[model samples]
Target: MAATSLSLQIDARWRAATTPPDRPCGMEDIETASSSVVIVRGKEADGSGFWVTPSIVMTNNHVVDHNPDLKVGKDFPATVLATDSVRDIALLSVPNVYPEPVPLRGIEEMPRLADDLYVIGHPIGRNLTVSKGIVSALTNDDYDDRQYIQTDAAISSGSSGGPVVDRCGRVVGMATQTLRGAENVGYAIAWSQLSSHMDRMLKVVEGSSPEERELTYPSDQTEVVAKYYSTLGAGELAEAYDFYSASRKARLPYESWAQGLGKTVFIRLVSVTPGDKSNSVKVHFYSTEEVNAETWEWRTGEFEGTWTLTREGGLWKMNESNIKDITKPTTSP
Candidate 1:
């Protein structure tokens, strides 16, 4: 069946009405944003529980791994679309339409500390519960350089994969972790980090192989792709180059190619099709920059290229010469 467009407003009402009246109330805008939330049910050691959405579910690898019955196929009702152990993020496909799929906004664009935020999910079997609070701090406890969105939003068990919306109802993060000793203190995997994973999933979705019955991408590949965008954020052009194949790096050197380009460039992996043991990856990139001392310029472009890796001295290196056609789209992001 064709997929349906999930509407946030409709889902929000559904969630608000279902939640307990005793909990702190969520904003009207937040209810409108709750349509994307969902309850993920499966038999784990902890028994059955719920999860929320953007249609992208994430949890600690251990939570999922602990449940040996939680196989990617069969037992785990949903598809294990993609996973990134480093970030401890996983993407699952919900066959049914949500009516609304929340968009992931960048971390730099998120609200400041003490700003109000809301967490929507099923806690203790009560689905669609909404918890509200303010950003307490931005901590990088693990030193991943990726800051966790620490908030007082009353997150409890079974809140994983739920939407953490800002006052405006825009999703700024996903409920991922929480502290056991602290009250109402929980952490969310920033939306920016989640987007990087979604981008890779989109590519897999767009480029399904005929022989492959399910949608899945290598965790390592997803990491490389996510890291590539992260590098772009820090203006580390050379580091970003490492993710690309050797030929791509040579042709599109960071310093020379990005010289006139903007400081920030948006990248979306469009698709990844199979190619004789390799893969054909398509990407869409949007860049904005100042053309001169006067005005700024904005451009939307797309790139399509084939990717392959070869083992050299027991190490896999991206084969630069394997890159094929790279196109630039005529639109903007």
Candidate 2:
């Protein structure tokens, strides 16, 4: 009798809609973007991946390269272009072009603790499922320099290699694993850790197949935000700084500007809304870290700012002078 009741309860939840019918929280756009995510099947396991470029998909190395039959760059659905096992990020070239490539956030734009985030993946062999959560923490592997984005977003057996995006619908990390005995604790390879290898990720696909001939890069405004932050997170300071307009960069030289970013542990975009003027975005951020060397304790707080981005030569660049801070600081243990 008890087993029967439990079975019925589980059935009811599954029968519930995978997504809300009303499509709240910009869920509609997120669902559409998820079209880029794909199921990666290997000899030993099945995982998920999303397109980074027209024909190139990014996923976990273990998902496609763990078993003997799933060799990178030689597999059928995707060829492995590059792999960083330490970060668990892999780049692959698919035979076809993907229409929607998810936008990735820069490392320097790390999500703040407790900020709402989401993950889309094929958990437990089911089709795509989007699970939501908050940024729980930023953790590091004791053995290496790699950092992990810890969130409560549910990550199941087959969810590896999925994209974890912030409320702004920007990719911040790649789903990797869940804690063994925990319910909501999951980890992803922060995009910052994957940023440095992006050149190789794109380069490996150049001229490799006829699919490249048909590829087209979309200039979505949100994608620009994603790339800008992901570049910063990956520690490509020069590249990220270049996202600022030439005049802005000149006014705030790299050295002085970078120095102003002192000792940040993590930053999360709490909200991103369109600014008053065209091509402007109002960004609300939250960051957490030690306030001073003497305490060495962690604290979280909110930051509000606006950016005026302009399209130059078919690319977006930030107008840094327009940035403003609207922070509400609070300390928590």
Candidate 3:
């Protein structure tokens, strides 16, 4: 059966708050709706996704780009199940997730001019962020000639794949992109525009794939380590800590390891390749590190390192790092 046909309206239970445009939505309703949002991280893209079904997420295709080792919400492994890249839409299988699916508006209920809309996303891959705007002008923002929902709402970087929900908390559209150097000009592809496509995509009957997915040689290995460095450079010590193998964590306490890493402010990944063996990755990077933590003077350096990761509980954790060939740091992205 199709997940969409004639029924796409917000449930009667949610309609109670629809009459008041200025009144805040019920806290329980908004929180549950927001919980459907998730962080999407791939080697090339960072954005947000939302649960369209219990086990399936909808996002912008540019966010995943068919990345094999995509991570959704707190590092949960994800797989690209479908994509219509031209439309900037994609769906992924995210097993063992608990966020509830959100409602979508019917075509008859499409937003009109000045209709209030709220964009919920994780801008810059940060926490849940929401921006408010009205339906500006409905027109083609791309070559597809499809009508896109243009809003003044900030769909800044990292918020690209998030949900654009209505005042009733029903998903009206999917945040797609923003124009550089342009203010408050962001485009979204409405669900009503792709209801048929989504109806089929949302039927996620496949069982969860095994959590311990092996990397496919060079490409996967490089991206895995690169994501680690990306997190490190962002000063996400707690998240980086989880990447360490249990045995490695046993040897190096979090405080000590974080203290050591604190010396560097940022790491710019240059090149990464698979090592001679399947378990290793070689990295060439540049760092802008603090010379003295107190004075905060920084120095740049070029570096090379080999990282060994151990498979544990369906994920790879860092086992060892062999860093050498450290010439003075000049920056390379």
User: Once model 1 is optimally superposed onto the true structure by TM-score, how far is the C-alpha of residue 53 displaced, in angstroms?
Assistant: 9.6
lDDT, candidate 1, at 182: 74
Per-model TM-score, in order, reads 0.50, 0.50, 0.52
Error of 2 at 190 (Å): 1.1
Tell me, by lDDT, which candidate is best. Answer: 3
* Range of the 10 consecutive residues with the lowest summed lDDT in candidate 2: 1-10
> What TM-score, to 2 decimals, does candidate 1 have?
0.50
Tens-digit lDDT track of model 1 for 66-172: 24334221233555544554465655554444443453333326568999898877775355688889999877744334657999888777676577878656667
Candidate 3 Cα lDDT to native = 0.69
lDDT of each structure? 0.53, 0.63, 0.69
Winner by TM-score: 3
For model 2, residues 1-333, the per-residue Cα lDDT tens digits are: 121211111122322323333434476656665776777776777788876654557788668643334422224455555554334667765543434243332333677899888898988757789999989999987644778899998998889989887655567788998999888999988776765555544443342233222321113343345445544554567767867777787788899988887666665554455578778776655666557878777767666666777766545577653445555555598
How many residue-pair clashes does candidate 3 contain? 3
Q: Any runs in candidate 2 off by more than 4 Å, and if so which?
A: 1-25, 68-76, 98-108, 200-333
Ranking by lDDT: 3, 2, 1
- Candidate 2 lDDT score at position 87: 49
Q: Which sections of candidate 3 miss by over 4 Å?
A: 1-28, 98-108, 141-145, 200-333
